[model samples]
Target: MNANELTIAEARDALAGGELSAVDLTMACLTAIDAGTPLNAFVHATPEIALDQARAADARRGADAGALNGIPLGIKDLFCTRGVASQAASNILKGFKPEYESTVTSKLFEAGAVMLGKLNMDEFAMGSSNETSCYGDAVNPWKVDDRKLTPGGSSGGSAAAVAADLCLAATGTDTGGSIRQPAAFTGIVGIKPTYGRVSRWGIVAFASSLDQAGPMTKSVRDAAILLGAMAGHDPKDSTSADIPVPDFEAALTGDIRGRKIGIPREYRMEGMPAEIEALWARGREMLADAGAEIVDISLPHTKYALPAYYVIAPAEASSNLARYDGVRYGHRARLGQGDGIVDMYEKTRAEGFGKEVQRRVMIGTYVLSAGFYDAYYNRARKVRALIKRDFDEAFAAGVDAILTPATPSSAFGLGEMADADPVAMYLNDVFTVTVNLAGLPGISVPVGLDAKGLPLGLQLIGRPWDEAGLLNHAHVLERAAGFVEKPRKWW
Candidate 1:
């Protein structure tokens, strides 16, 4: 029945109709996992435990199961899972299972979703490529003439697991393109909600102000279905907005016809690969063909977004990572005689955090330090506000959404750019960072593929709380573009 390729909604319907059983679905996923674990796609799998949960879900189906009842999903290790080893792909947190489950996972459980296991991610969700994980990175399921490819990060494992049909839909977090980039790499639908739309409670902090958990699904509607179950406010997270949740599933039916989509002129800059440029142009045409009016807009402060986000997110990450000082959590370095409490903290952080994490922490601390606070941190914040204002102006000018390329190029090899200078690697995030700085909702859906046969994706940026509008346009574009992304043995 190709259970691996079924959408989350389809799997649930099959289970409900008795055409499939929770145990049957779980077994197929476990079988796939057993075959793919050597690919390093998962950090851990609880098949026995997963089967137990599946049994419970099936029992509930016998009683009055809901839409998502009995579907198994892969959870990114960044989310806290009680009793499941919830390490954020780091060495220090090894064997340090959390005592509680994250809000998102908890909500999914209430909706009757089962967990296959914990998927891999970059340590502390730091790197763009999952190569920085304490565990090995996830290999892309897509192949280009026997050559290995990449599943983007820090949600690469989630993307790869879903692509490999190891799980239905997986949870992902996008601080600055983590979710969307990986989705692009694996040809899946990834949506990062407007900041504060999803509760941050129980998520291991990376860049606190920017960290947002979302869904990675096979279809936009499935993404909406999963998101509907995950979105809500929680008193535990102070930054959570108390806005009423909408039925995103119902909202998907709204038409984006006659709507306005703006193409930020600043985004189409020099050095953009030809394929990406073509995809962006094709995206605008697709929207236009679907009755959307495409406008040429300017965001002068757009170029400053990457720099500001690099500074701001690192600063927040440095603060959020301070809790991993070996006493309250994670690993702690041995204290020496005559050394004060401060030394223990310093040594612990040095030993616990990986190289990339330490590099970011130092950069963050330096920028937010007393000497450079105003010149760097404060100025960046002001620039961030200006960037958001740019979006505000565009939205006010009748732009319902913005369209752009998801990446400058398709997925590269596993280490294709690892040593070609970090600046180049960081540059890969150029297209997705601005959306984060504006605190807007953004998604990446497969638009087409490059000549190398790697997947290419289009990014959709939306106004705050306008996710419904964004998804509607995305679905319309999906059909209008006729971008069928069936890879020949790609997954």
Candidate 2:
């Protein structure tokens, strides 16, 4: 395989064996990124920074090397990389270079990973498709009928970069299916560890409670290796869980015998495509063949998860984004002659935020308004609790994991939904929002293809803090599916 095409695990082994140097791998990725610029996967390119890190990794070759030694990876723009522009794909934070690194990225660097650049994402992670990005929509590497498809969002660029072989893997944050949906769309592996499993210290907040950082890689094993380097408790983030970080790669024994996998009845929504249903059925049979027991289950409150998530996520986003007024860091509007402070605030925000972000902020502010708080936000919180309880009940009944379709459908064209209702876009997350609402671990593994030759993915939802087992089960499924198709490089 080409150096740029190597997975994290493969690259790490080659580097350690002296078969490949870190500089060669880094340059190969840089070349791929340069050639794939039409995809708009990366909003920023840090070739110099990548080379410096590669040289340093080369120097630490012998006994001092770390687990991720000499690995080249991409950082999501949402991550606060010190001295790098971390804009989160929003114009409000354009040119805002943080002075410190996020805890997750810091841990990856400590393990000797090199940063290629910052990948694109939805503006403030507010959209299901990457169209909300201020940096222009990231085109999926996968195409159908010569149409440019979307690489789901808000982690679209991470998924695109990985699928296109621009990087070994990339950082991604899941806020209501951002990571998993995009991974599904682009035929890659993405895992959102249980909330608090990975620190959120310097990641730009979208919805404080639901957003969790994870890895987007070329394979299940690569996801495991990257997750190990990214997961750890951080004192800087109060929500970070103080738990033992396991060797995620070592946990992939692929021995899932006797494990009970749940097929949630609620996931079988009306109008679900026959292809998705067939894919789900195939995933069940694969797991059953691997010695896992398949059991019918019901997450009764699943219907309400999407509604409750929209309410709660937007409410938290409104509060969290209030800090972006022109007074502090990030872009500020030029004051007009005789204009008041209110005018500056309004104009600056109006110019900075995208349409989708503004809409959510308004929805959030209205939901949290004095007269509507009890009716909307508070009610949503109660419904959120019930959703969590539903998952809890399922786990208590011996369901080791839950399997479902990762996305409602395969990737759609980039502008297909532009004129459609916003709620239509929101429906894309119907299969994914419940996992974020319940704060559990979820992974998307590409298993098959849709009618148009686009990839389809199966999601595996696990109990809190049980990522090791979740990854093991996913590994079994991946091996059974054996999907190795790559996008024909039309870009």
Candidate 3:
């Protein structure tokens, strides 16, 4: 059996049925990672620890088993894992080990999931491509051959590991498009559940309001399974929804015969590559073919989403990341000190944050500063309200969901956009950011390959707490698109 290709749902069923032991699953993941290391899909792999956990899980099955008796998953480095280095893929957090695991990760543990190890990512989940990692970039698995293509970031490694079958599925965080974009590039399914659906407490916060963790997997059902394990109310995370957790697994109705899907014309912009546009059009056709009613809708605030997200997310990020300045925790950079404590904040911040992080902080500082607060930060906040209002209007108008190209283009070669103006790179997140800003659920599912043979993905957006609807829509499109490709062993 192709263990690498097995979905989390399938693997658990097999494990439950005693067809494959947790030991078998662990070995499969370790073997796949050993083979996939050339692609640099993972930052860390603790085979011994994983084996121990698998053994414990196998023993538990002999006692009382659960749905996730023995699934192995790649954890994004951003989630704080107690006693493990949760570095956020940045040099600044190099030696920072947490005393407590993030709430989402702990729940995954309780659900009986085994940890494969920490996966790589863009520094502080900042970039569109994985090139921003202090450890170096993660390569896309489906470059058709050994051709170099970026696994999208900041959750690039999470997506790549899933694509290369390095892990059954991996945890991913989407502050902007981190999860969705990378998932799109690697030809996998990744969902950014509604903001606050998954607890952010102990997650290395990039942008408090926008930062959210979800699942990256080969199939929609797998995404659903993992999301279920990661999501719940946590008193520790004030923003976490107090709403009831639904049966994400049970919500998978393979039929969406009469649903209304809206195609926002604003998403069909001038900069979108022809291949991506075709994929978007193909998605509409796929849903229509699946008996879904398709309609043309306008998210009048669409064009404003990217800018609004850039402003608000960074503003929140600056505040959230302020804690990393030298003293209390993380990599204490050698900062020139003045006589007092205030000097530490200044010197430490200057030394600790990377250039990109510094840039956002400065931008945030400038926007939130006395003179500009009303004009910049406040205006962006108002626009955020409009963006959410736009989604509410669409849903109220009877639109069950919306569709757009997950990315404007497929995976670009690493370093192609790295040295360009940082704003240039941020532009690539255009499609995925709005969902985060609106606190709505969204997903990316691979649809086809591009001219360079890199995978392309189509994104589906749904109402808040409507992950099930999003997954059903994606499954329908996945079937209609008829797209599936595996990484060749050339790497």
Report RMSD (Å) for each prediction in the order shown: 1.7, 0.7, 1.8
State the displacement of the C-alpha of residue 70, model 1, in Å, after optimal TM-score superposition: 0.7
lDDT of 3 by residue, 1-491 (tens): 67757888888878877888999889989988988877787787778778988998999995566557788999999998888888888877778888998998899888888999999998888888988788888988876544588888999899889988888999999988899999988889999999889999888888888889999998988888888888889999999998887878787777898899999988888867888887788888989988999999988998888888878877887787777767777666454544466776676666656677788878887888898989889999999899899999999999999988898888788878767888788888989888988999999988888887778899999988888888888888887777777767566
For model 3, the run of ten residues with the poorest summed lDDT: 331-340
Q: Candidate 2's C-alpha lDDT?
A: 0.94
Off by over 4 Å in 2: none
The RMSD (Cα, Å) of candidate 2 is: 0.7
Tens-digit per-residue lDDT, 411-472, candidate 2: 99999999999999999999999999999999999999898999999999999999999999
Q: How close is candidate 1 to the true structure, as a TM-score?
A: 0.96
Clashing pairs in 3: none
The CA root-mean-square deviation of candidate 3, after full C-alpha superposition on the true structure, stands at: 1.8
Instruction: State how far residue 252 of model 3 sits from its true place (Å).
Output: 2.0
**Residue 237 lDDT in candidate 1:** 93
* Sliding window of 10 residues with minimal summed lDDT for model 1: 482-491
In order, how many clashes per candidate? 0, 0, 0
Kindly list the per-residue Cα lDDT of model 1 for residues 380-454, writing each as its tens digit: 999999998999999999999999888878888887877777768777789898888888999988878899878
